[model samples]
Target: MTCKFILVTGFLGSGKTSLVKHMLSDWGESARVAVIQNEFAASGVDGKELKLANDQFELIEINNGSVFCVCLLGHFIHTLERLLDEYQPDYIVLEASGLADPINIVELLQADELSERLVLDQIITLVDAANIERSLAMLARTRHQIMIADVVLLNKQDCYPGDLTELSRLLRSMNPHAAIYPTEHGRICLSQLTESSHLAAGQYYGRQSADRPEQLSACVVRVHQRFTQENLNALLAELQHDCIRIKGFVQTPEDVTLSFHSVFENCQVAAVSSYSGAAELIAFSETLTSKQVRQIVRRYAS
Candidate 1:
């Protein structure tokens, strides 16, 4: 059987991980799932959130860059081919990095490597209702994500509590063809996840990878020293900036590991009982360099 390919893309902190988790839990019951988790950071923090059945699903992580970028596209194709050959999964769900430019999806589906083996099932893009306005204004890729989606999920509705009618209208203006749905915590009906997108495979709009900018840069920051919850909050507060997004695991003074999630200047911290990775965060910024992040981390962490 040809593998069904579901590509999930969205901006940072847009509930992409939550949506993927929901899919894995709900869909894995019937279909064999293989997830391609492409993370911009070296640490696959988002992969940790997926609750998988050992026999029902498998995960492949392509980290440290966008899979759509020239930097990782070749590797991405090769990995998919290998997974299809060895695992023979029924569904291939790709959780692309927030910075990914998937405009070349049609070109990829038509590639000599994946054409016969894979079928494009759907292009689901999640829009963080609370942050969509700001993201649309500040990031070009945000518009691209919406423009190419077969189904657009206006997620985090509970957090927004604003005028979604207008928001929906704006999103429709971006892509009149896409089906739009309001969702909270990335919740959506199972049919939406399982149904074929009905989009013509070659119907992709002309916008391609050349339009994506390589302005964003990322680095992993590891802290061996433990911190009180208070210190950890203070440290993130000091470093929050308009150009950056951060997420990963943090070590507590009690030797516990806590998850950290930040978008722009806002963040949410929570304790996790199962985390085992080093207390390191992957930070991405449009203007900050790796050396600069390391210096800032040293100063604030000290």
Candidate 2:
């Protein structure tokens, strides 16, 4: 049977992980579901979170860059091929890196190797209700994400302080064909997202150009020393400026490993297993220089 493929795309911290976890909890037991999580950071913090939520589905982590990029496309293709031959899952969820362009991903799905075996099921884009305007104005990729979506989820509605009428209007302007659903904390009716029939290759709007635009760069900092909760907080405070997103695993001074995720000013630290190797913190910032990021890491290292 052909694997049903769903591509989930959104801007950084738009709650893609939470939505994926919820979907897994709802549909995992009934269907053989597998997820391919892509991150710009080498460390797989999102993968760790998904495993903590549930270990039933096959989890594949592709990090260090967007899976659709030329640098990582080969690995992404190989992994998809392997999953088809070995896992034979009924459904496959590709949780794209927040910075990914869904247009390129759609193009990849139509590639000869995957076209026959995998079906382009749906493209679900999550919009952070509070930050949609800012993201749309600042990020070119954000527009592309909305344009290609089969379903546009206006997530984080509870915390959205602005007027929904305007946001909804903006979303409609971007994709008149997409079904827009308002959601809180990424919660949505599973049927609305997953029950759609397989979409033909041409159904998705927008095609990426042969030459892809440059993506936001990332800096990975590997820390060997344990950090106190206070110390971690201090580091996060410093990261809020110039950094679009932060994620990785860190060992606390208490000897417990904690998964770290930060987007804009919001931060979350969840307890995880004891990660033995050097704890890493991956930060994505458009304005911060690599040298500057390394300097920040060194400050915390001391």
Candidate 3:
């Protein structure tokens, strides 16, 4: 059977992960589903939290870069093809990195390589109701995410006690064609996850606005050597100023693999059994350059 593809896009802290988890729990019992979770950070925090039966669900974590970007588009295509050939899953869900532009992804799907094997099912964009106004004003990526969506989930309603009518009007103006649903913590009816005939049309691209300057950059570091805890701490300290999100796996001197995740001022490290020993870090500030990122990688990676 041809795999149905669902692309989930939203900005950081927008409850995309929570929505994916809910779908997995609710649907895993009945259908064979596969997931491709892409994150700007190298660590697989969201992938780890998605609980599904191994027999019926397959999860592929593409962390450290946006799959829609030039850096990882080839990798994304190869992995998607591999999943379809080997697993033959009933459905495939792509949880785009918070910084990803869903429009580029839709264009990629129209390419010959993926068009025949997989169908562009729907684009689900999750909007954080409480921060929508601020995000839309500050970030161009946020607007693009909303513009290409077939369904918009205006999530975090409980936290957003302010006027939603105005917010709804703003979202409607962005994509008058999209079906909007107001929800909290990304909770939505199970039917929304099911197949829909609303495949995104290719004509939308012609009318899209010109590309905007990218505010986010993903710098991936692959390390072969193990690091001491103190060494890792110092690296994170230096990155904290420029990076808003940091994640990936690190090997300690003792040969233990640990997952690393940092968002803003907060950081979390946990021991894990297996990892690629590669670090994918994302910096929000435009101040970060490729040269500086490579220097950091050269210092830490063996």
Candidate 4:
């Protein structure tokens, strides 16, 4: 039997992980689900979060680049093919990296290897209502994400209580076929996603370029020594302006491992060791070079 594939896309901190966790919880252990999580950097935070929420589903991670990129496409195909052969799950949820440009999604499903085994079930994209305007202005890929989605979740609605008439109109104009739902904290009934026989148009609009734009870049650094929470916060504050998303695990001076999730102006730090001894912290920024990232680390990490 062909496995149903759900492609979930959204910009950084749009809550894609929360939605996947919701689906896993709703489905329960009886459902055989496999999740493919892609991250622009080798920070194992998201994968760890998924396992913590529900360990029943098989989890796979493709990091350091988007699965759509030519550099990582070969490895992604190999990993996925092996997973399909080894564990035949009922559904496969692909959580794309925020920077991922899924313009070639239709072409990907039609690939000789995956076409028969995996069916394009639905393309669900989450939009951060509060930051939608800023994200759209910052990146063209954000618009492309909505254009190809079968189901578009205008997530983080509580963050923006103002009238969404204009925003909704703009989104509908991008993809008239997509069903847009206003959601808080990315929570929504699974039935709403698949109420129709066809959720997505399965077509990408505007620029069909598969190339990941050069502006966005990710830098990964190992946090070898423990630092004070204040120091970490300072580093986050300094980076948050240029870096859109900064996350990973950091050790405290008192030997406590804390997970950090920093998006734009907000930074959430928790004393949770979700990952397995992975101390690499990653920061994604627009137009920030690797050297600059290292410099910032050196200044604060001292």
Task: Estimate the Cα RMSD of every predicted model relative to the unseen true structure.
Answer: 2.3, 2.5, 5.2, 2.1
Task: Write down the lDDT of every candidate, Cα atoms only.
Answer: 0.79, 0.81, 0.73, 0.83
Off by over 4 Å in 4: 197-200, 205-207, 273-275
Give the poorly placed runs of model 1, Cα more than 4 Å off. 51-56, 211-214, 299-302
lDDT of 1 by residue, 1-302 (tens): 79989999999889998898877768756888899899877777787656421335788889877888877889989999999999999989999988877877878877799999999888999998888987888678788788888899999888886899999999989888788899988888769655535463245645466434557777777776676778778767866762467877777767778888887766889888766656777787777776777677666452
For candidate 1, report its TM-score.
0.92
Question: Which has the higher TM-score value, candidate number 2 or candidate number 4?
Answer: 4
Q: Which 10 residues in a row give candidate 2 its minimum summed lDDT? A: 196-205
Candidates by TM-score, descending order = 4, 1, 2, 3
Candidate 2, residue 203: lDDT: 49
Q: What is the lDDT of residue 181 in candidate 1?
A: 92
Q: What is the lDDT, from 0 to 100, of the residue 66 in candidate 4?
A: 87
> What would you estimate as the lDDT of candidate 2?
0.81
Candidate 3, residues 92-134, lDDT tens digits: the string is 9999878776676657876777888898778899998877776
| Top candidate by lDDT | 4
- Model 4, range 206-299, lDDT digits (tens) per residue? 3354567558888888878666889888988998988888888878777778888887786788887455666767888876777787778768
Q: Is candidate 3 or candidate 4 better by TM-score?
A: 4
lDDT of 3 at 92: 91
